[model samples]
Target: MSARRRSISFALFGAALGFATIATGPAKGFDFNIFVDPEDNYIDASAFLARGGFIPVPVIITEPAVDGGFGIIGQFVRTPEHPGDQPPRTMIGIAKTGNGSTAGGILRSGNMRDGSVRYKYGFGAADMTMPIFPFGLDQSVDYHNKNLAGFANMRMRLGESDFWTGPRLIYRQTDVSLGEDADLGPVASRVRDQINNLFDSKQYIALGASLHYDTRNNPLSPTDGINGVLRLDFYDDAFGSDADFRVGQGALASFTPFGEDWSLGILSKYKWTNGDNPFFTLPSVDLRGVQSGRYSGDAAYSTEVELRRQFTPRWAGVVFGGYGESFVSHTKLYDAEGDIWAYGAGVRYKLARKIGLDVGLDLAKGPEESIFYIQFGHAWGRDMD
Candidate 1:
């Protein structure tokens, strides 16, 4: 399946697994005031969670890339033992999309060893159907994918600093086959042969490391500060992988607050790969309106900016735009024909004031399509760790 399908499926599976392990009941005499921020009187979940409440947040996945879907995620957060320590959290849920895709899994994140170390890990399985446009051709072919994947990462904070570094491991096994009813008619034999060769079963194992620096006011959401990461992965036969390749990725995001009611957020990312690797593993231009894997190559880069205005104590509005490109060679990056752009607007609600968490919706338009996303936290906040 395509990259977007895999992402959607894994997200659903992980959430379902996590939710399955959690058991909670309505609190007796649950105080409604806990849902409101004390300082600003805005609706929020900070107090309720701080008071040991478990929240079952509905997951509304509307990205056109995955054909849209819905699910529920149950989140349980534990207060930190110390003032500056990281709070531990568990999340679980499941989801299915209109395209007959489904998944579930569990995730845990927290600090250890007196806040010196942080860890996140999860496992999930998914079955999905996705459309693949081969070799940038307008014609699309359907493919079915079944996969199980897992990953774990551990980072140690540099003593008294904002930097952290860590090792990471990932494993995945996948089976891919052409959709049973797909019709590839009137196509050239060479192109047909290429498509026929794309199906297979594969196992991948990668070992990687990451360097990170963060000074954001809040990890879940941010009004100001900078966060950045650089990571490298090596997938090799020595690691029990079917292919030998190296991948590198880097990303940076910064938020700047202007006065009390305005803020600006900017994000940039770059990824590249070398050596023999599957086409689906190539770097792609990731943007709001573009489907993942629709514009993929050996290297890719993208940047986006958002300007936000706080309309009220509980509501905010934002406008954003981005540009990206994917190219077969780094030397041709500036002149790549795959260059694309997207722009959009959205509104946000302060769902957890104390933690700076926000929920919102956005509608974006790209070169080919318009898409909407039901976003939790920052839209550019994925894989920040």
Candidate 2:
């Protein structure tokens, strides 16, 4: 072949490949999405990085410090070919909120079969404000917390179903600083001292087994299916943990489809810790738009339901309401702020159809405050299930 003829042929071939990719990209479910809060009001902008497969894309984002800023909740994850999954690529990022609270972490994750597995180990630090004094006059306190947490699990398919029985281990070292609060100081100090090593830094190892079942249509945004997890873990000094305790936790979610493109998702979570464990490490009312760990206790449980309707091809509307509370004793359920109620409405845009994931914004009202969330993943969230 002559040099000139070969060069012309190569150019044509390259052009053909580029055109093919552009044609099929949408069908393959790859896209980028961005949005701002107060959808109609346009108060702030929100964006995130979520890519599947192996596309080497570089991203540098700077979010202006306004309306409590933003944080990296969860990033784009790799998709598996079949029921089993694997981890994605190595990732690292940082987040800063508007209320003078900042948090950041680095993660290395993947699944062997190239599926989705919520397995990652990272370190994070946050300076936060908690409304821990529901019975008191202040109703809020400022605290600083730093922690290193890791999730490592190995699973095998069970009985031709998406359910998996696996042994998993969780580790965390939390060092908390409960600073002075003139209004709630005395009571807060007494509560902190009651729990051994609660005010200072503490480390605990959770070694246990989990039975997880997930049949959600989409790992990202499921219009149907059930995802549930039952976990029993133990922390003891024998495991080099500063506190000895037994932790039992379970979370179950089910999405049902009803009238015309409408789906109802119901999710419930329960957690209990027995023994000398740091007060902050227990599970709290993890609801939408609520302050992180705003309500925590030795035992906690909650249930929430969200109804979604596909009003448009790429848009869906969501309305959700839930109630949860944490308490040291059963009688505390009647205490002030013991019963936490939250509800909100939001809009969702199908961010990426391939994974069936949706990006959404919700305006939620907690017990005594209202907040907004720009969700990277579905509200039901990710975990062993």
lDDT of each: 0.73, 0.57
> lDDT of candidate 2?
0.57
Model 1: residue 11 alpha-carbon error in angstroms: 13
Best by TM-score: 1
State the lDDT of candidate 2 residue by residue for 235-326, as single tens digits.
88888888888888899999999987899999998888777766555566667645655566667778888999998655689999998877
The parts of candidate 2 lying over 4 Å away from their true place are: 1-67, 71-76, 83-90, 113-120, 123-131, 134-138, 180-198, 330-338, 383-385
- Model 1, 1-385: lDDT tens digits are 1222323411221132232221122223335666545675544567666776777766666655557787667778766665444567787767787777887777888999888898988887778766656566656666677888888899999998999999999887888766654454656545655655764788889999999998887776577899999999899999999889988999999999999999999999999998877655678788887776677778889899999999876678999999998777633222343559999998876666665667777889998889877677778767465
Estimated TM-score per prediction? 0.85, 0.72
Q: Which candidate number maximizes lDDT? A: 1
